[model samples]
Target chain A: MPVTKMIEPILPVEKLTYLENFGHSLRAASYLYKPSSADEIFDVFKVAKQNHLTVTLRGAGRSYNDAALNGAGIIMDLTRMNKILDWNPETGMITVEPGVTLEKLWQHVLPDGWWPPVVSGTMTTTLGGCLGMNIHGKNNYRMGPIGEHVQEFTALLPTGAVMTCSPEKNGDLFYSMISGMGMLGVFTSITLKMKRVYSGLLRVKAYPVSNLHNHLNEIFLAAPDHDYTVGWLDATAGGSGMGRGQIHAAKYLHEGEDPDPQKTLRVEYQTLPATMFGFFPKASIHYFMTPFFNNPGVKLVNTAKYIAGLRKGEHLQSHAAFHFLLDYVPNWELGYGKNGLIQYQSFLPKETAEATWNEILTISQKKGMPSYLGVTKRHRPDKFLLSHAVDGFSLALDFKITIGSRDKMYAMLQDFDRIVLQAGGRFYFAKNSETSSETALQFLGEETVKRFKALKHRTDPDNLLESNLYRRVFGS
Target chain B: MPSTNRNSATPLKPGKCAIIVGSAKGLGGALARKLAREGFVLGLVDRNSELLVQLCAEINAGNVGQAFPYVQDVTSYEEVPALFQKILVDLGGLDTFIYVAGILLPTTPTTYDFEKDRLMISVNALGALAWFNVVAPVFQALHSGHIVGISSVAGDRGRVGNPGYNSSKAALTTYLEALRNRLSRYGVHVLTVKPGFMDTDMLKSSPRTFWVVSPEQAAEDVYKALRQRRQTIYTLGRWGWIMFIIRHVPSVIFRRLSL
Candidate 1:
């Protein structure tokens, strides 16, 4: 028998391990390769192709869905390649390998008076993951997504081509690949323009909103003056209290506002405290919070939070303290227990934001599976082909899952997708786990899907790159 | 028990050494006989020392090929590496390896025996992986060999009768498929055997059975599949279509059936 020549025995059975999404709900048994350089990543791709296996790209594996899982295939984990290649504090320009995290980036440039232009709610996310999903922050309405700040990038294509893309050169690829969700190629290097900061502290303000209408109106109007604006809604509230929440808006201090900039800018002063109340380790807070993971328990907490916000306050908060509330209690997601949790986030135009969300919140409460936490952010549209943003507002709801409630939760989320699509809304792939292929087609349209497929054909004719998310959202 | 050479005057084919795991009784012993009849130098491994000695004596009486018996429990995964190397050295060189070691504990819809389930999985699933991991690199270096794994048709669907057995077989079936996909390019053949009902001690106490075959007949079928280098086979063949339908039955309906 004439056998086809295969790559050498580089992938061993011992390399088999489980790769799970940030939510821990989606996972796969994959052959994991932690590559430290572009050449090593290429070797992994070669091995995957030779063995007729698909390769999924992973950077910190922070996606909440199946975006980073390739079941029974190969996963190229690029976190080992973390390296800050170049930095220019004078011009606020920096170049880095794909694996560098927001925590590393901020730590590297805070003393130089520069900050990442856009960052996720958690500081542990990688730059590659941020760009792959085109993540946005509370300032999305003004700053767009992280991809908008990327000046240029170089990627290793499955076709064995090292291509450099920018707005002026290979602009089509530059736009699409950023939001391609790691299907186009593996990013080797990325150049970005960081926002210059005068101080390490942000002036903050907090207040309460009465209902869904007030919540949308306040954020839409406040986004222009504030550098960051976010809202926390009570998903269990209903009947005149629907979408009732509190909004926190923050703005950067001017050069002269912070009298002790030198002291505040120091990494030690800006880092989050490791312990709470000077004694309790923050790592174990999740265990204490686990008792309140149920609907009735969470409702009480949300009510207490809303009542506390009614006091109305303003104060200067450290940049890290203001941006990384999700990191306050380490492994807080574990509070939801073994089944984990899922976030269903939808972006709707300003015209239908209030009504659509009102219906969603009411239905969830009626079903007795209300979300534990609801976060709202203002967003403006972007140029990425697979863009999830809209010229309106986005609401993300986190629901606790149990073995008895999993199937019902998924069915309810599908209903939410229907309502969002009917209102001309879009969804962020990184957040939602249960969106069907038809929902994706409805949101992205036939023209954009065709164009994406054409690009995939040119870059990877053999179709060697795939993920559980890709197959779920776009048909196999 | 000690390793004994039978038909020492018979000259074995070059590189025709084979090892039959669980080769003391039932399907394993029958397959060993078939391979010996085909002029292979055989290594027989099993935990039942008395049965191992008896089977070795029976094969030695044929005086056609050689047999070497090694007493081993497949569940002792830690001992697999050294024993595998010893078998390779004792037989000179290995061209084929068949892992048929498995256990079926009594289970019903109402029973949830963690001890029994854990033992079955450890022996049937993880044991195959431990031995196969050692065998894979050797065959990859040689760029040619045969790996036969005995899975089961019970893995085709999730039945309520035997959750642990079904899951273990499902894990083995999927692992064998991955091995076949990876090793085929190196000219190494990996065959997955999914047998239906068999008239052996493992299933003799069951009340209802269908399409049951004798151990000798099943062994012949497996030998033919190895010779033909088939990727997967269902001994008695009809189980393939039966499983194809069973696998497609909607879960809501399938769950209501006793099966």
Candidate 2:
């Protein structure tokens, strides 16, 4: 789609994906810009701001769970503004456009023996998205979210004004913007602090946990000290004193563990087509595409797969493979079919961990609804305006929308809110759907919300960049 | 129960208690839909508020029977018991406990990307336990209940991708096996699932390897397996023999094999 041709139908498209912050997935209407100059990037946002359309800035669509989605207006996809503006090899710091992917950043820095300090679960997500989300990596307990790694950056507010801010300069905007859930503005570029790397090989340790309690103990034990650690739970197993089902811990490896550090480190992962990839989230792909029962197909492949698994483990990386991983699994969302999907992530105080997990499970057991990727992790408190992290544990889950049950899901969520509020937990701004005013009231309180309201009034008074989240929480 | 409409309008089947851990969406979402159709009340738990809200809206329209959603970290052991009690107090009992809450980490080799492994271990391993830690006592107190777990067939053995996932699943299956053994004495049904591939977001977002089943189909299969009290069943069925061999393969050979 040529930029000029694609720009015509910007408003009428019905399938827009609204992100959490000011951005949206208006790919259908928004023209893909391949700007040869930064001036052009600014021009895109300027035109949208002047046209009275909602404007959002986006990097690689990696701001998970709609943090990067906005539908009421134009989305300025910064993916094209990826240029390395500056680099300090000695300081291990680099400044680049908001569109530069962490993977792309590594390509340049890794050769010089450096690496980005923080990263998300996957590599395909963009550096700008990382900043905008202020993502927390596996080593967060030790390093904090991605925001702590940056020196400064540029964000363009809805007024078409670009501001360069950092901890020392425009600190309020800096704090509010990084993990601001993309509410403040769009990031044009960032100067991120990178970590020095050695062998680039990651030496790992896996612990088998019997149950949730043990997992938490191990997680926190590793949290204050370990360089990198995370824990996964087997939500399916329910029994007394059941431990060892968990595999929890990892640390970067040193030299000679892998025969060739350079080769292993640099190997790029190219995603295979859906035909070869088994875990794609498409309903048709999983349901109709298979000749046998879905479970049976998975089982049938297990024996042959067991052998294949060992063959791949021998390979290690001096540098992590990023684009190759995503490239191999292109457009995997087709598997979800047309109904689309939803991902939910939230946190609760560590003290309430036991009551919360049990309550959810007990409810799930009664409901007979089982989520696919049940994940659990710990987090330290974060100061980002509306960042999801608190001084407790967090969990993220995936869900698929069906033909006629969205309402049921909504009702269930309301009660869940009561329990979370009772536990003194708040919804992650990046991941919530419809938090009741009552629940929102509890978290934000009338006074805090009033203050934020005052701030929002001062900054985006027109509510120029509106979103589903904004309407649900702020009633903007 | 006899007159309950397990269809589009009144999606739940009455009398069946369901605990949907990751019931926020996809297979879990579809499972909730099916269970609701069967007249079963749902206890939906998810990290995504949007989906949870959407779910509540879908079920609460026209003043249908009520359901409560608990925003929780299923992996937190202490929270599990109270959750069980609340569900019992609110909905009155525990008939089924399904751990569906999960986050998809990109399926990559564990050695190179330790984060992926750590995540797989945590979500698949500890997250699964979040349900068990809470429910083990509830079912034991009740003296009889069903524990239906969504264990992936990937856990059967290591594959070319995501050994972390595979290991987590395998460990989950093993733990479930042990749990089933312990629970069987008290008349509890422990049914473990090895779904090959389901048309869920995780599958959609990742590279496609298997022709997946719709969440409805997967949910239907799971429901049947739970009702029949099958100790272990392959979701797609085709993956059964493969996993059977993988499960029994010698440790040396297994370790030598590529995941």
In order, what are the TM-scores of chain A for the candidates?
0.97, 0.79
Clashing pairs in 1: none
Off by over 4 Å in 2: A1-46, A239-245, A254-260, A267-337, A434-441, A444-453, A458-461, B1-259
Share of real contacts kept by model 1? 0.00
DockQ each: 0.02, 0.01
Q: After superposition, how far is residue A87 of candidate 2 from its true place, in Å?
A: 2.6
Compute the lDDT for candidate 2.
Answer: 0.61
lDDT of 1: 0.85
lDDT by residue (tens digit), candidate 1, B11-57: 00122678899889889999999988876778999999999988878
Error of 1 at A222 (Å): 1.0
In model 2 chain A, the worst 10-residue window by lDDT is A22-31
